[model samples]
Target: MSKSESALALPSRRALFKSRLNNRTLMRQVIARQESRRSRNLSDAAELPPFAVRVLTRMGFGPRRTELAPQSAPNPNQVFSDQFQRSPLLGKDDVAYFESLGRNDDERLERYVDEQLYGNLPDPEWEQRKAAYPASFDTLDEPLSTTYSERECQGFSNYVVPQRQVERAAFARACYSRRQLLELIVDFWHNHFNVFSGGDEDIYVSWAHWDRAVIREHAFGNFHDLVQATAKHPAMLHYLDNYANEAGGFNENYARELFELHTLGAINYLGNTSPLDAPLLAANPYSGLNDPLLDALNISDPARDIQSHYTDNDVYEAAKALTGWRYDDEDIRDENNVCTSGGTGAFFVNEADHDSGGKVILSGGLQNIPADRGALEDGEVAIKLAVYHPGTARYIALKLCQRLIADEPPESVIQAAADTFYANRTEPDQIARTLRTILLSDEFKDPANWGKKIKRPFEYAVSAMRAAQCDYTWRFDDRDTDNFLRTYEGTGQRLYWWRTPDGYADDRAAWMGSTTLVQNWRTVDWLLDENDDSDADRVMRIIDTTLENFPGNPTPRELVAFWCHWILGFTPSGGWVGDVGTYYAHEPTALGRACMQFITQQDFNGEEDSPPFPADQQIPREELRNDDWPNRWHRRLRGMVKLILWSPNFMQR
Candidate 1:
């Protein structure tokens, strides 16, 4: 039979079921290994592997497989050299620039950080791949008014399509983008200023605009600009109930989150304390009540100083400042009944609905907004005050440090980053400057800080795909893509689907649950499956195990080493190589024998057979000369790869 025909030979349903059962057993073993590793990591002396391994896994996804040439007889010695030459998936110029960074770790990291921060590098391959998505998705780039009228309210039939397109595009970018640091920063900003796309129909239709205009545009720009853009965006307006905020009725949803979650953080929240009684810094002590209303209230505290902490009064006043800020909706109308709001889905102040009242914000009467300030000036001042506050700077810096360094980063790094953030609050590249300070800090490069964080589900899935060199066609209509997304959702990190304003948790404790781990294993299993038995070309294959990819009859030890370098970015010590090689070589363990029977379609009895080969021993060349060896080896290799992906090493950042 032809090689292709042999590869496509169908297995019986019973056989498939048994294979799945065996996979479950293998998964359990991997989970046990993970638990042991976790215990070790908690120890004071736990050390990470290497610099490249840690940084690549943390800063980007993981080490990607470089495209290899088809060889008649692949030499293992040449594989390491060729892998770093170029990546077929990334732009040639981009790969060249990356390689040109430096020879050593410090030089490479310094150059790479600057390049990513400035975003001067071009990724033609990524751009071309993104352009291949359906042109209908281009409408997402239009203004919210256009999207709302033409797509959400009028012409387009499906409101969910825009959100789906955004989600798919995000996954594609995470998996393939050459500008990995920019992508990582964009993700950080998204979660920081999160607005759930699934919660409101208006948000669903304008989700693309929100992602592009608010998050991606200002990802590395000024934090002040990002916050202002988010405050005015239709998605945020609707998601936070700011759209419903009006004169007589105040909605504190957006305003409260503006303080607690967005800017100052809940760490700065001081509940129900009268502004007059709140404490102030010794450097900036209270002078006198600035607003007449505060004087009229007869609340007096000479010890009270310039607002060091926000009170419940702050949330109330901030809500009043944002009272007139809302998007133009279809329901809005004018005195002449001419749809004066334009149904544009853009931000506009409704003069009639504005509170138009003087407001005292923060304790000790700092930032007093005068009565009847028109054209949304009140809201603008409020946003500026909140975003520029010392607490805001510290809060943002702490979060950034947590994301880039460790879960609980050193106080010295946080203070340094916060100082950078506050110093350049007005610069266009303020965020970039702050990030540079953090990335180049001693804490970031310290080996003790490495492997202290766990990969969230989204990171795990994307890193796996990148490492495996999966041929992912990220089209909405492709069944494999759809199935992949569906299975990924089971791990509980569905993109843009976090219902809460806090977004997904970044702490390790939140994701180390038993259910999440098992679901992740199952997801990897699905990724490596040959979904179509009759058509080998239609399979959802992650890696190709033929001679072209792994030329010659390599011993099981060599095969395990190659994949470990490819996936884990390092070869692990201990008897891991021997144990996995034993499984691939079909040695005499119970699971190994079952896997062998499944792949070779032949049973072996330990009682009747002679002594089994040692785990480190290589499989004989004669046994590899069978007509169906390529097909059988492909099946066996898939199992071994799955185990590697499921390993504790792969689970770390």
Candidate 2:
């Protein structure tokens, strides 16, 4: 029997035929592994080292090639905690992009983050960096070369002009940011309060400000502050048509969402109390509540009479309080484009249009807030009320857990995080501390929940690029940038383009459709190709580095195993060494074949076997030339890379 036949260990000897070199051994092995994995079906997730792998994959993007430590499988909790305490660092591509700016080094935000741990600027530095960006960002940061005084830049509500600097920067950071957890949360928050920039020209201007001045600023801060920032931003005002809201009319858009989507969440009608059936409320059976739909949607509030649950009345009341909030530029463009005391990020109030009449809110408990001048204090009071509402804490906490842990997060985990959020209500890092509690919990580290959340489009692309250590280059053409950006859009979760108010969903079913699932992979060709060609050299270099960094020159098993874990975050079942061994030998240098043979544990007795099959099936062996061999083998490597990336194993988080 041939060496290949012996290695497979087939039950019957009938399959042991001639050792012809054109074998589909590797392909067969892949098929076998797929079948084996189906039967195992994550049965191996909780095992020691695999458990470690599952933790990293779930917590952040799967680890980079150099990050795998099979020798010392670290505890998942320690890894989770360690990431939070460290400061954000610059990534390799970030360093490269900054270096290319020769004289602008001091002005780069990349340097600021590296040296100062935050992205604040003296003035010119921030604007210079913005201007240096590709034109795709212009909609967000137009007048890029010009500088804005700190006071002027503060919520300066200009007109609707959408730009994507934040989206572009976000894409780069996710691919290369050292602060992994922060980036992950930033994305979560953005989606939580989505404003479709494509709605109008106004959103372009408003979203850019919101993305930078608001979302990025408050991402790690208090949940209240985040709620406040979004509540008053012109983008949200315009997205929800609150700008047109006046005494004569009302726009329930922003206010309704503020209670239903942003703060209390759709299902959470109870403001700050647990359900009647909750452990804390076990003593109370019929907690005093007077509303039906509110109670029907949310459990009966134990503190019901004390903390009133919301009703349709609350949405309109909040909207009444928010009257006169609109973009200063659009609101009074004829007035030399002047805005409020605050600029773009600010929600300039048109007092003349304000509902100045004093009124009561919720008509219940402390929830009943007093009215104010031109409804000014009303807006502030409305935001404060919603964010501090107990339901807000639970809603935000549960969503955070869902994003960081599982789709169906355990009640214990949700309650624990909610408790932390409520306890540190005013701390700037309240969200940070709350996340720490959930991330460290056993629920997050549990391997059974490893693949619950699938990667979104931007997340998947950036992470894949980072894993491969991909060198991202851009064509000078704006068209190229648009094409590049379209790949992100292809996943149906494009940033700043969610037309509806609720934004992108964390639910797996939203992105995981029959055709949409494959679109993410189909566009990878552009990401991998250099200058848009089919050459595989860039991938080859990355692979070589991955191979060389190991304890020893890895055989095919060692090489493929490392990537399977590094890229897919799980080890392959039934092993893949033998087929890779056959692939390498088809047309390889003596050294390469030797490495493959070693990985496969094949006997290399220095005796020649039959020559490999011809490269083209159409031509007989006699017609083929020796020179064609190199091309065949290179093609093999491409196949291996694609199979690893496109397989079902890599698709799940």
Candidate 3:
């Protein structure tokens, strides 16, 4: 088989994680979780009915409570496909408020979702709010430095504050955007063309420039446009240390990742070794000879033994090709080291910093542009060559298919998607067209692949908030937004803060650790006001408000059932509704206490107190065991939301 075929055949990060679930430690942890919730609450082993769950979980931020409702459409696929035929822009979901005009109207669901797909949706309230907010969506046309303060940092307050504003808007879009797929695509491109936000204190000034102008602007536009835009974007220029890449010395950081992570993928990169490095490897260097990633991660077979499509010399040549690409505002000394500001600048090439050399790329194509003319032409040519290569199509297609379908997606689907990509190489909607093929394919909608993908921390947090209809406020003035981001501190995905060029891994194994379990459970505060620490009122408001949004006035059992239907997108296990309904029959506080202990205080092992008996059987709430039954029932309802939120089933979507 071919190299691409060999790579695709390899077991993915999910398969690796699945294999490890059988390990003694993981097995014991699962068992302990089961034992703790011994009131017959099955762990992830709980069966969910087919067709109830939607593939939108992988496509967007998962389905909301309303989305989980029985669709009025007789054929759901037709309604879903009608929306995709149009183009998509960014969503205008306010992170602080769940309300969007017509979002709650059952009849306008497809119409609303369709309009957002093309960015044709009218969000009058959002427009008004944008006019009032200082975050300047106008950065799409200019540099972020110019939009914010061009002045130097004073304790980084100005930089961070505006950056936080952009971040809040981004989070809001993820949580409430009608254009879920569009936001998801933008996120994919952002990570693909990632520039760490925390690297240089000054970088925050250029954050929106990169996000708005480069990534988001060209997200659905074209493959060539996106690559070229990111390669020249100031945030990326500085992040990869390409700004310092001069004629005498070259940094292969950006060029290497451009091939390894962005376009060709690590499987095709072949490392920094070339025929010239044969002498170095044969002589034995001072450091570890074996690949650290291969060993430490324990990847076997084909993935461990990948064929190199390009070598280190090619990366060096690529860096030389990209030389002199720098932003304005850089200090320049014309002669005698006299420094003067170039002022706030756009992308431009400096001939003095460029390496005037003929180079051979991976395809053995000669790039011999004369130094006297076309200084920036070779870099552009090189990017075009890389993007159009057959490997790039396959690699990029695999990722698109992986993120949309299962981690170990079927080879048939990948080949089909890659075909679409190559066929639409010059089209404006190249990536979108490719995604459309994969998304609408039988592979994506197949029952086998429904929950195959795992939810990253960002997806989890946003989906939970979306389902709960969270009235979150990330305003710096209130400090809630700071706390929101902090909650993601050690979690799976921290938006825009990754320092490395590889960006965040799509691999679920990279995230599913023991400690992350508790953290994931603790983050259910978005669902209910339990963590609000208020004496009263918030719980009742949350419970009452959430129930009111649903169809009928549901009792405790029916409420639990509706939530199970909404949150899990399926019915609960056999005894679940009865357990919740019977226990929360009158005073819901008992249900609250049960779920909190099951979630908040639970850990990896059964090293704590014995499991509590069924509330209906032992210590009924009528006695008000330790607290007033009537007073605390609202608190118990909060606990119910938490229980559903923290379930392993919810973790998958």
Candidate 4:
């Protein structure tokens, strides 16, 4: 039934020869057949693509960290997150008190509004408030001034801390649980409806809610409603400056992004990975002047006479219909000048500030506005109208399909997801179901797509730590090391705070550069070294358990290739081990032993690019190349680990 069993079934040579004396030719044919079969089996091992091997290792709880995930049948990310979910934030009473203070009971709600605008009103002038909240701090480099180094700036800022924590917890869950699908979902949703953590007041606070409320809530839901919900979110409002928009102060930042960044990006075909050389239009209306239609959408645009489906004037008119909105703050006084206890922390509508008369939208044309519309209700309607546009479905569908399927998804995938979006209408949960259909579809599981995607830094870093079985106790209070993690949050990959409202670049071309490769390699080295520092025994245990049957009796070259595939997800091309293999051939057993030491030496973190092994380790000197093979084997194995760390595969994913 199996190879080992069949081998045992073979008769002894003396008995076999005697029995087969009259059938020598038959015995010869059987021997030849056995030899051929062995060759085929060995070749099969080599045929597995490096990428596939890497993908399996990184995506699944493979041998190295199987304990983290018990080969469970269902979701991986969920199992992982559940394992580490905050144990209800101990001291429930304190948390409850804070939460209760922000609760929206009717009396507290009215009082809260009163306090936000008027309670702290300086007697002489409200001019300071208006000055502090300028109409436009439009340039990318303006408004926010920073003198700290990248690392230092990241340390002090509380922005993006929540997301970093959430992502790490999700990663830990994946590494330590059987639910692989859950990790995939977290990544999918986070990317699908991406939001930057840095921005103005409402957005700054609202981003806290968006991570779980908007993105995670509808992660597995329908794409349409996810877009719509995000559009309504104050974080989106603040980030896109929609709250700044007024009846005459039209800003298309939100509207344009509703199309470009959120739903259907500028590129027409789904998941096309081509670099956009054309002027990059903003995902929100306020991205910049690169777009003619968008430039016209700016509140200050003078071309008021231009006739078009969607124009700056229309955006301005829309903004006017949705003005006077402010966030709910416990310490804040309302416009009427009273201290308040509770209200929703969002853009509030000021009836006086809103120009609620009927207006014309370029795309929808002359829509009648309700006469009694208030800021909150009017803004909600505007967001709804923007999200329900015909183009919105197509835009959202393509993005959802891309996140679930491929960077280059098929037309069918887009169509299917889009159809689901349309059917689900405005329900976020329904949209998640549509996404689940795409994630669990035949197309998603195809072999051609196996490892087709590259690991984002979030995936790469967390997976590497998991592979090494590193234990991390990340705490928000631990500012020193917390700073390092925070620096990497959404800043690396050039997605730094205040960089662009359009969000991070999400394709291969955007990520695969020499700088990124170097950074990745350095990061890998740091993590490996950290793993060694944290728990050397645990690291060793993971290696032993993970590579139990690696390459079966592999040659030196095969061993090198195997390590690459197991860790980095790619086999080194032939040149990588050509010389090493030649040396290894002289004493296969000895060279094989060297691999273990090589893996251990990866503990060195100081200079990531420098080779970790001693020069003597790479080549066997005559004195060390003795027939007493065990010692020589140890030396050779030491070299293998260094080479493994330095291999190209480690640099990529």
lDDT of 1 by residue, 233-258 (tens): 88899999988888889999999999
lDDT of 4 by residue, 1-653 (tens): 34422311223333323332222222233334334343222212122333223333333332232232111232223321211223232111111211222222332223222322123322221123223423211111221112111111133243334434443345444454434444555555555445555544334433435655666556555554566577666666666676666656666677565545554445432222222221222232223224232333341133322121233444555566556654433343469765332235443555666666755443223343445556665655555444544455666677655554456778877777767765565454665446544644556545554433445565555556554445443333344335436444532642224346555555545544444444544454444333332223322233343335342333435445445444443333442333442442232222122332232132123333433233224323321223133233323332344334333223222
lDDT of 2 by residue, 403-443 (tens): 87767888999999999987777687787678767866767
Instruction: State, as a TM-score between 0 and 1, how close model 4 is to the true structure.
Output: 0.56
lDDT of every model, 2 decimals? 0.67, 0.53, 0.56, 0.42
* Tens digit per residue, CA lDDT, model 3, 1-653: 42212211222223323332122232234434533433321223334433324545666786654222223424333333334223221231121111121233333333333443554545443345455554444443455546433432334665555455566667767765566777888888877877788787556767766677777778767887889888887678888988778778888888888888777777665555663432211211111323232233232122222222667766777888888888775554557775432246477888888887765555333333334333487677557546765668889999888777767899999999999987787788887778777866778767666555557777887778776656543344435556656766657567888878877888656556555555555555533553444424232134544445444433445445555555655543453445542433232232232232221222123333433233333222332212243224444445556656655556664
How big is the positional error of residue 614 in model 2, measured in Å on the Cα after superposition? 13
TM-score of each: 0.81, 0.68, 0.73, 0.56
**lDDT head-to-head 1 vs 3, winner:** 1
For model 2, the superposed segments whose C-alpha errors exceed 4 Å read: 1-52, 66-162, 270-305, 330-345, 363-367, 473-480, 530-559, 569-631
Which candidate order results from sorting by TM-score in descending order?
1, 3, 2, 4
- Please tell me which predicted candidate would have the highest lDDT against the true structure: 1
Residue 291's lDDT in candidate 1:
26
